[model samples]
Target: MSAPNVTKSNLNFTELPFNVSDSNMSVTESLLYDDEAQEFDNEEKTWMFGAPLLLVFGTISNILIIIVLMRKKFRKSSWGLYLTTLAVCDTLLLYMFSLDSWLQIVFKVWISDETVAGCKVYRFVSYFLVHFVAWILVAVSCERIVFIYFPMKAKIVCRRRTACIVLGSIAFILTGVNAHIFWTFSLTEYDGFYYCDLVDNIAELMGPQFVIIFLWLDLSIASLVPFILMITCNITIIARLIQSDRQRRAATSDGAQKSSTTSIAIMLVSTATMFLILTLPVAICMVLSLNDEFTSTGNNMDNLYFAKRIAEFVQQINSVLNFWLYCLTGKAFRTELKAMLCCGRFSRTPGVSNAYVTRSTSATTQVEHKPKDVKTNGQDNTVKKAQDDTKL
Candidate 1:
């Protein structure tokens, strides 16, 4: 897109919030191209068409996490509540991006009808929710770390209400601060699509010095701070897990206990991986946005468009995979999920195929049989043990 036409005096539309139009303000012709505009239209359609799947899968996975965690027994733990919060955050992500995607898909551009106030609200909510979700994941990882380091303390510290309060505060502050973006963003119509742009009228209002300040502020608050906090927490949690086995070896002598710890580590690692994958691309994009050479080209637009789509896809995959990964690796999650899913099966045949049964049987059989020729024996033992455990 060509830069919006601006009067010489109004060349720097960097105003935050909205600046009242002055005589100096003048419209600049759009920087849009005949060919690139067509490509942008096509990309919008592709994003919109694929968005429903992301929303559907993301919504369903988060809902399942909530349902699975809401059981009477499951609710007794703090992690269950954290999972519920995580699900809610994931759902909100889908909800916000869904609107943006659908708008782009249907209109092939941003809608110009929406006022700057409304656009600001949308941006604020989306940005706040993204940050809130990232911090919540950090909280989850820290909670797990606490569980590993001080089990008793974790029981007291990782309360649901406390998490809610902390997360809510973070969301509120982030949202309020991000509302500043709206002051700078004004709607412009290009090829029938309305886009919120900071480079236009608002930048002119704020002037060049204020614009530079705004850029750095945005980078620090939105990207640097959150990234540092999340990565630090995740790395610390991983470090704790690595040390946990050696630290607790004497205390937790049972095979099941050791295995459970390993699984918990895997679950945390998996969750962290999702956040890393999604955020890393966006972070790189943000850095690239500051490059004069990159932003000056049509290629910058392509790079940004692809990066955002990939990030969305990564986030959707993360939301969907949580249940499966937790179920596959964590005995506790598997047990809880199964009970939530097929309550009747386990209800009538109590303890059948439960974590304890599976873990114990596998351990006993492994000890009894030769390692090289143990496949058949292990299978038989697991089945038989499951049956016996159920009968008891």
Candidate 2:
């Protein structure tokens, strides 16, 4: 009740789920709760065992994104900048989440529950990053929409400067918004063990209406609004892409443009779709759990919690999947990835004799030696055009 009871033999401390008082609970209900608890443990093990894989995978994948995007080809691309920032954020978010989860399950060390400051800071940091990442997805989505719908002005509208400003604004605003979590969560003790949770009298402290409003607000900021934007953007992008495909079909000279549009379409749709599928159930769980939080005796609480844990695990998979998505969907990304993996043994200037040309013509290099300036400019323009084409 006042956080999960430590002395209760049937109970275990977890930072991820909220607790309800066991007063007047039925034996059947207790058994049901224990059953749900077992299921959650199994779920935890599944993700936990996969944790190291994800750690290696998510780290290398996100790092690849960062490294690939930071290359000279994408240096001036707004979307490239956005994606690089996203990769960095995902790396941090994944580390924070996976490490906490790993520690909680393996060592049974709950950092948030260990100290009052730890409780608040942990919540604040994690919540801030979650909100931050969601909106970054939204930001990229909006930029993609702009690129698709308003291609002529995309360069003007979506610049690296603009991206940096947008990212800074998001971080600043979300920091202010999630800062309340520091005070909202307290290190609480029940039967000699600790939990990071709200006070039992939270309703009395903040008023029931305020807490309700806050939860709804939290749901909106963290999930609902972004989900709506993502779906909307996906729809708009698909339609525009269809129109572009038809138009490009009639034009013979625009073969390269067609390829670019296809790649962009795949990139946007795959990323947004992953978010939509994974986040939907999390939002649903939040909606279902809203009313139950106010009740002293939790009704169907185990079911709600089961749903929540499942949704959370699904959502987390998104962070690790983006690099693969880009690799699969973007031909250019695959080319670059291949080139990187092969260590440039495959790189050669088309139509130019390698022995006669003493200079490397690959776009990955930043040196502007006079002999290669022409090749560099040509590559830069091609990359610029492709970047412009990808805005949609």
Candidate 3:
């Protein structure tokens, strides 16, 4: 039996054999191939046109975030620490995924699929970083809850060192959890192209039931649990903010709290909301697509593919929006950004001194009026005042 000469030009499979008794097995071989070249080519056009723009803009935004967050003023903030870490993650994601997309579009190859080592490393890092991003949001929300509900404890608990520990722990834990990807995915060559995809031999090694359980467990931990936690934490923070607003308003109409905390709360809430929206579709599609019964039908395959693409694009948009959200919601952030952009000339702008005085006075007033004795914890008070001044 001779093999048919398959090329890039012709993909027609109608002439392929339909009987198992056929001596020429090229048609049988072609029949087994899942031809998605045309679909991928269309997606490549979209990636080529859009990915470069996102890569450039996202890179610039995250760089600015890092610059602003690195300043001594903002660096002391625990929230600022988390944001800085997130900015780093976003920058890495842009570099990694955008380059991968460009290579796929232009070269018709995935570098990660070229070798077993590349496949394992790419899958492991990609999964670990993604979940790390989600968990960081969770951590940020938890910090905000503490700040709003337990202000006194927040002063001691939410330190830069504490944040670093938390972030490092998340990286370590997620890295360990996703280590199985090193074995789950391997190089699969089909139609002269290699893909880093699941090893079906897993079913033979660990049984199909184990594979199904693993998929479900991964989906639950990666998306479902984190999504729920973020939502719950953000909701509680908002509720506390509202309660505090009402009490403060009733006590003194002129006692306007500085917009710093309010602005940060708004930004975090918006971020969490975006995370939920962008990630939910991907989670749902993953669950459905992984089901044996659903995939075996082959009817909803195109719809599932389209849904996953859209969901993934939405998720990528999440990495680019945080910087803009800070600019939009935080007046302090804009001032710092302006200063950085103008080489410190913006600090000499008229009324800047008065704004600084008003902010300092407001912070002082809040600290002095507190029921707790500031003299007992003067150092904590001073740190808190400095943090308040630098708030975004």
lDDT agreement with native, every candidate: 0.58, 0.67, 0.68
Error of model 1, residue 343, in angstroms:
2.3
Per-residue lDDT tens digits for candidate 1, residues 177-282, read: 6667667666655545455556455546777676556555555664576667767767876786556555455444662344443555567667766667756766
For residues 238-356, could you state the per-residue lDDT of candidate 3 as single tens digits?
A: 89767767766775666575445666677777877877887787888888877767778544665566556656656677778888988887666677788667666454221222122
TM per candidate comes to 0.69, 0.78, 0.78
Instruction: List clash counts for every candidate, in order.
Output: 24, 2, 0
Error of 1 at 168 (Å): 2.5
The ten-residue window of minimal lDDT in model 3 covers 1-10
> Where does candidate 1 have its weakest 10-residue lDDT segment?
1-10
Candidate 2, position 356, lDDT: 13
Distance (Å) between predicted and true CA of 182, model 1?
5.0
